[model samples]
Target: MRYLAHSAHAQLGSLWLSCVGWVLTAMALGLIQWRVWLVSDRGVISSGVAWVGVWRACFNSHALVTPGFRVMHCRSMSLAETFTPPEIVAAQVLMLLSLVLGLCGNAGGVYALRNIYFRTQEDSPVRLAFFTTGVLCLSAAVMSLVPLLWNLISVVTNQTIEFPPEFNMPPAPDSQHVGCGIGVGMVGTVLMMVSGIIFCTYRFPVRSQRPGGSSSPAPSVSHSRGAAVNDNPAFESHEDL
Candidate 1:
């Protein structure tokens, strides 16, 4: 029923990493700064800026109101709207799925760790629990990574999404750059992978015989020795007499 010598430490490490990763993933999903756009016009020194995310887009315009006055507007993305890009839809779906999986993994990991450290029950399926946790964490990592990478590629390629005229945003900005959300997502994905690998490494300790331990004679050998002594002439003579 014993596990590897370092199994306890490894399990604890995995639990912490998974928990942090889950929190980071949630933050990334909620943040609306996946891509940042910087806008500038000839007449205005500081014109406007916009940002887009999986769930929404926001705009900050200084020239629209008054000189040196900044106004910020945000719009919730709708799947029914034609302006919503396919990438945003995909990101939304995948990020949500990843968050859900991460939550499950964290719960399973806590249960497994509790059984390993607190409950000394030999019948507990700690190994299976660890394995399941690993699978869930890795799946979450993959799900989160796809959208993060896709959005990063789009940002690099200067992909644009058409904003409605009411939002008062340009179709394309003068320049665009990756935002904090993507960076956080990348870090979270990496932590998830590391935690999963550590969980998967948990294994039962192998039992090995000691070299200096005494060995007992086999039953067949003991029986043969007894028969030879009984058949000896000295014992037979006594029996016959």
Candidate 2:
């Protein structure tokens, strides 16, 4: 059976608190981690791709080659190098936006949850706070998705980089496959979406009342009092006298 929330300020409060965790999880997974993983190149010995994050590219030596020690080589990527066709800057911009929005959403959720928890009497104010948190969370989740989805499309289309006919030096096999970072980002995205769903399910309840006043008037007992007076024999005799 489905139940609806009515006059549920507390429900909104709890939803905001949950939103905070989801927003943070998504941000941490999607924004801070690498962009994608690169398949290990069989042609290369003692070396594999380090992990390609949005801002940098790196490579690592296998443990068998260096035993007991790990080494990684990395370099920062410029917009020209990172994006294919060089003119496509949407991915970069969307990624930056997601980071900012995620932080804002997380902060908003924390503040709203606090208001709901600490100041139960402030119904209107607390309700507003929680609603705001929910909106922020929902928006942040959307913003974070742009980069992840963009990357997925690119990987599936094999469009990470473009090569001219004479560019030579065949592309590395590792570059052909999508990386682990994409999966991590997707997981984060799912968490954010779940938070949004929870918030949406319970919202600021509307007070139901008729324009004239209450839907039903209070019951009257005057008729019962009159009946008792009529039934009293002494009162009837006195009236007749």
The top-ranked prediction according to TM-score is 1
Model 2 residue 44 distance off true place after TM-score fit, in angstroms = 7.3
Residue lDDT tens for model 1, 1-241: 5644356688788889999998999999999899998887523324356778778777654444433435655677977889888878878889899999999999999888888777765634888899899999999999999989999999999998888876566768899999999999999999999999888888876565556663554456445765986879897788788
Cα RMSD, model 2:
6.8
lDDT of 2 by residue, 1-241 (tens): 1122334454455455445545554444444134344545433223444344565444554432233336544444456663343212444565566556656666765665555445445455555655665666667667667766776676666654533322211254355455666666566566656665554555554556776778776667565766887989898888899
- TM-score of candidate 1 relative to the true fold: 0.80
Candidate 1's C-alpha runs over 4 A off are 3-6, 42-47, 62-70, 212-241
Could you tell me how far off, in angstroms, the CA of residue 108 lies in candidate 2 after the best superposition?
A: 2.8
Models 1 onward score TM values of 0.80, 0.62
